[model samples]
Target chain A: MKEEKNIHTNSEVLVKVEGLSKKFCKDLKTSLWYGVKDLTANVFGNKNVRQLRDKEFWAVKDINFELRRGECLGLIGHNGAGKSTLLKILNGLINPDEGKVTIRGRVGALIELGAGFNPILSGRENIYNNGAVLGFSKKEIDEKVEAIIDFSEIREFIDMPVQNYSSGMKVRLGFAVAAQMEPDVLIIDEVLAVGDIGFAMKSFNAISQILKTSAVIFVSHSMPFISRICDNIILMDKGKMLLKTNDVGFGVQSYFDNQKLLGALNFGEENIILNNVKIHSENPRLEGIIEYGKKSIFEINIDSLNDYPKVKVSILVYNMAQINVALFESRYISIKSIKGQKFIFDFGDSFLSISNYFITVRFDDLDNKKALVVSNYVNYRSFQVTGAERLVFAPLYLKEKI
Target chain B: MPLETRIYQKENHLKLGHLFKASFKDMLSSRFLAKQLAVRDIKAQYRQSFFGILWAFITPMFTALVWVFLSRSGTVTLTETGAPYPVFAFTGTLIWSIITESINAPTASTKSAKGIMSKINFPKEALVLSGVYKLLFNTCIKTLLLLFFVFFYGVGFHVSQLFFPLAILMAILFGTTIGLFLTPIGMLYNDVGKIISVGLSFLMYVTPVVYVIPKEGLMKTIMELNPLTPLILTSRDLILGNPPAFLNYFLILFAVSALLFSVALVFYRISIPILVERSNA
Candidate 1:
């Protein structure tokens, strides 16, 4: 056999997003004027582009990645890591503030379930509209209409208006349209967590069928799904990337590592003012911080930002719905003295049996009720927890036969 | 651990023109979507009601009566063929209802469908266009009621009255223009939708829809300046053949439509992507 050449072709990459960032801002002058002067400035100087301020909060910041033709790229990161921002850029639903993204074919992004569907219209009508949105023609949508309905398993209500359908049915129908249309690139956010287990299973299997030719950029906290299908993983945090790799297991572990680190470091205020913070976990995902039913460690470091302080640097456990479930305020619980700007909080010995949770740390200057209970003046990191926690935020005790 | 180094990469968007065209193309191809939207629009009001579609025309009919009673003292002056004041009032009311529905169509037609813009991949214009089809349905039914007045009320009309279609077309053109002009701005500025609706309501009386033609200088000029005024007066003129001096405003509205629509298109195209990426609060 002839020696192989080491050249990579353009066709190899289905997508190239370089320095992709998107920023949304308010017109400061208009915001300031609040009257006619601001209106004039908005109309005349809006396009000046130079007079624009950098007070921008970048939703997706400096994101760079490429997806090959058939690989599923898992975008795993804690909340606010800009995963949704990156997915929007790749899907062409929106543009970025500062990067270039190139894709070879039709891209279907289900950023959220039921996003492009008209609820007042019938399920059948929405399917056609969604198909068109996914880049299919009327004939094409027509051809796939039956298949789409069958896949969603909602044929009985196909003629009924979507507004009347339940949430799960809506998601199922939405996913079916996105899948049946056969887009070159498919971007799915955390919607897989929605629907019942059977439906989730159905969605994953359907997604698998599409993965044969489609280059997928899936942003989900579900490690099993990532490991099962993603050819590579892109781990991100706080609007930046943590790592990228084909080793799915390693990626999952890394996700947990930072998660644990962030939660442990930032979950609670070690002091009145929080400063230097971090989180880590043995599972690489550091998932133990938030996900239920997993044993994990949380490490926190704190410093005083503004001094009149009595605070706790500890872990605050929140369920996925953002409800605070429990908290380990380490400062009042443990530390007796302060030496410098650093304090650490350990979750002691606990395997968070809950399936899903997030870590949030605050330095409250007051009590739990409102009179001036300031959660310090800073926000910390969060991570995920995994293992035997087979569901979302379900705290349970497992029996092992080993 | 230190913060993960987020390497900056530039995201590339296809040219604005290309995306805009693509979005519009996406909207145009979905006949089924448009039909369904039109049906839904018409059905939403009358859905599950025992009166069914009759309520669509009845509500407007009663509203016209209240306005007529409030405006006139039962004068039989509206009689084109000795028809009663109520019949003449109904004619103006029917036309006004159609125009109101059409103008209101643009504002709500697309605005209500914001859910789809963020979730699906389809061009958003289909939603905007959906309103037009729905309004057209309402207009058709109301016009049928207008014809009912023509036949049963025994109103007299010259063949020149055929120009009413032209007048109605003009009303539609202006309504659609307003919709196209304001839809994007409404999305950008939270209050734009409310402002457009209110402004249109004020302009309705300024047009001859709710009142008679005014006599004077800048007031006439201002009255003439209102786009729908010309269409309304011209329809009455079709029955009488001496089109109002406001006829010049037709050309002006045509120009305004182009300008407003083009500006709307540009703004919509520019703001779309940014609007889509906002979190689902």
Candidate 2:
């Protein structure tokens, strides 16, 4: 019987979603009672009827993805990108209107910290409640209870109501419950951003340890975290998956760049979306590593604009090599601020040591703080000094360095 | 992929027995919360009134008193056989009112419990089911009051009246069916309450709650179509020792209950996904 059913199932892959769609119903439908009156021609026009006139909200459309075992897939998206909804569907919290989410393993999700937890209940009470909600039996909860409590480090207050607990405590308990649940598949939905930095580090460490045994799906805005943790990144926007990438910085930059590329902005002629950014201005032969005290100038040419836009321009240079550096100050003078305007500043023998540097261009007037044009990356232009670099921001320069 | 699709089918089409058991467990665990909510509903209904829950008894008593006055004035005849006219009207109205409240419950509870659903990932049916639970509690209270009157007013019960609960079940079954079908529509439609309001009360009177039975064919057809008629009559039969059509009420109630539950499960499954997705997580 199972084989017969499988034969009927179109097995393209394990999980095949051809064209997923979701529509949201409004809270107070205008077709409410007011519509009845209006349809009967009692009033001029029914506000309720007008509101109910046409309220069909589509949240997700044509969403498609496939996941296999041992894949640490990262979902990077902006707010309301439907990542959490997708996760919730995967976790069996709710059923989608027009989509299919297929999974083989016992999927586990930390979609939000303490998603079903009750504030009035004590931590101990919540453990059982939450565990039960997650589909664990009472006996299973009893067995994992000790490890969960110990990991959360809320033993002292475990018996106290969660309303009395701090935010950190909530996340801790939530994380501990998930960690101890030992699911085959784990999903983290930006909840890791909570808690202290140290605790975050500890949580990620625990996550990494768990990754050895399970597949992980993570949603985050932290690019570096995605880069370091996930094997591949899937970028989503609105309800669509825009790009899938293996490179960390490139993927992060692409996500930001895609927004500008695909945003509902009417691009005038002479306006460029800045498709590809590269800084390859070869100078007096800098070697593999630019050492300390070697004078270097970063020459950068930004390629953008369909047609040269008429506007003045300035570039903000940044040192991105994890070196102690000040905020970048805009120090370029461009007569034209229009599109396709390129301006470069030669930091001739600047007081900066060997490090990777980038420059970003932002266009805006002072009035409304509106940033008309912004690039995720400055320029790929990087320079290094060709000598021994001991001190950072060097020019602890000794006069008589024999 | 098809198997996966089957597995991902919406709103867990749990077997009926399993669903009932799970809901039962949830209600049991949440009994304290249910009590708290029912108390709030009951108290809120009569808040700041001198006669509070006594009002539950008061409404039926006044209705009966009006009937008495009408009879004394020779305005109308109650046409009672086994009991006094006032006692007859009082018992029927009291039972029917509670049952009607039960039918109207799922709608009201769905509207009121939006606060809970929006904030928590609870079983949404809890709100709907709790309404029936509250009605059950209310029904018990009303039944006890009726029993007191039956004894005090010297109305006797036959040995066959042991099946009063079976009659109550018919009422509940019909009530739950109607409640389940309308609650989600109520959640979706803003004016559902008003529609149910004027419509259901008219339905109550037509179902033979407060008057003598008319023997016209049209009246019988209307009575047959009322859905609550069998419930009221069967319950009256159990009390008054009429040859109760127990099997007929059982089949009708059972079939209607199944239909309502199935419809409710479908609506719940369809809406729950959208509800969660649209929530401000």
Candidate 3:
């Protein structure tokens, strides 16, 4: 009977799940009348799918987990912190008003990667229509269609028509046919946050060669690709699992210590005001974060509503995909009729690497040498940096001895 | 390594014999993703047409030439259709446009595969079997224009007209069993696909496709309680050859439309994961 159910059992759990949940409604006509009363109480059986009716909610709660054959879990949160509804209920694509998932062999989902592309066909016929919707088999997409047209380098526009290619050559031929879907468990949403960077390091090395014999889960916000191929993690927020771990760097440092610190200070056209914006960090841990190449300072205080022999402030910073890595400025710190004045700056050994950052500041008017008027603010302040050693890709680790 | 577990609960603990044996084993492993999504939707449906595949023989020869020019200018009065009213109204609107394109092929092939079923988890019975393989490739070009209108209207051939592809596969299995029981409320309401194309054009003016079933009053008792009047009068009497005037009411409406097409494929596999979790984004 199919070779007694093909019994090759090495580390075998494959994926378990359990206490999972789903809910969700936030009104689309009362979530389509609670999806036609939970699909007529689940097609006439009517077990009443455990509570919470009107205005629903729990977009995946109680989500327990498991994964064996070469484990990898990770699912960190924020962005409706349900982590793509628990990877669409572990890729069965929905249905978990309560719990229990199971799964075993075949699951593959690096989501929407050319999901059945056919922009008038032809990228070698959408690689056999996205390799027969990722289940493969037209003689295994004709023996992996010449390595998916040589890892989607376009191969002279693989016979033309995918609506004339370019959109980074249709996301590098949809990540080379979802990296030739081998599938044992694999899930991976945020399909490597979309292309470009040598095809995201050749699809992160074809998803680390299909994560060395499957059993993944992933979902990300890229806490360094979830601390590089996660061993286990969870985090999630609004819909439960505040933290689950197998350490993966303290579950990605408690998902950046449950991030919320935006540190508001807007006063746009209020000219110049703020009285204290600190950020000292000699080696501050969690709460203030900053440790990597330690020495920091950012004082500020300020008041100057009018006089100015010179001013020029600037700051900038950013990162956390906000990009603008670093910049400083200052030089003319007179603020003539200065009030609370403070000023500081320093930031000695701050090479910037670990992560979280913000800061926009700006105050000018160096006697209008066209440095015109003053005060600006936007995303005013925020901070976090912690290291010890982990700079695989570097946003800024410049120790510069070379 | 085909361990094959796949549990996923909450459908009242499933087990209707494992949901009809996993919906007939994912409709037999979605036959090569329903023939590669019906050859990538029949080659992107005629690669942006320009008379490509002659627009499926010019849409049922232009709705049978506007009902053969409104019953030859009588403006709509019609009766006595033994065969030859423009080849019996172009084989009754080419078998009523293959039973209204098999009742709009399982909700227009699951709404043009709603962006690949909300980010892939295949075997959605390959989008209603790739809409019955693009309604049998536009019913093989409306069966070669109903064999060139039964030999250009002379209406000769007979071996029971070789059962006209089994009466066009019993009008696409009884219009895909009431379009798979109106595709779980037409994939959750667009008013059940605009009330099934305005109730199949007012149900093609009460059945008999383009007039014929009337032999008495009350429009022949509403065309004998219209179950598509024995599948368009046995596919226009096996395409004008004859001997099939409701052959036992077309074998009891093809055994009650093959038992309502296996109860509309087990109510389309228990309402497609609750209509894919309320039509996911």
Instruction: Indicate which candidate wins on TM-score.
Output: 1
Considering only chain B, report the TM-score of each candidate against the true chain B.
0.77, 0.79, 0.37
Quality class of the docking in candidate 1, CAPRI style: incorrect
- Candidates sorted on DockQ, descending: 3, 1, 2
User: Worst 10-residue stretch by lDDT in candidate 2 chain B?
Assistant: B2-11
Better of 2 and 3 by TM-score: 2
lDDT of 1 by residue, B87-174 (tens): 5566566666666676667557555666655555565566656776776777777667666766665665668677767677667766
Which residue pairs in candidate 3 have backbone atoms (N, alpha carbon, C) closer than 3 angstroms, thus clashing? none
Counting only residues 3 or more apart in sequence or on different chains, how many pairs clash (N, Cα, C under 3 Å) in candidate 3? 0
- Model 2 docking category: incorrect
Candidate number with greatest lDDT: 3
Each prediction's TM-score against the native? 0.69, 0.61, 0.36
For model 1, what is the alpha-carbon lDDT of residue B88? 55
lDDT of each: 0.60, 0.58, 0.77
lDDT of 1 at A137: 70
Fnat values, candidates in order = 0.29, 0.12, 0.75
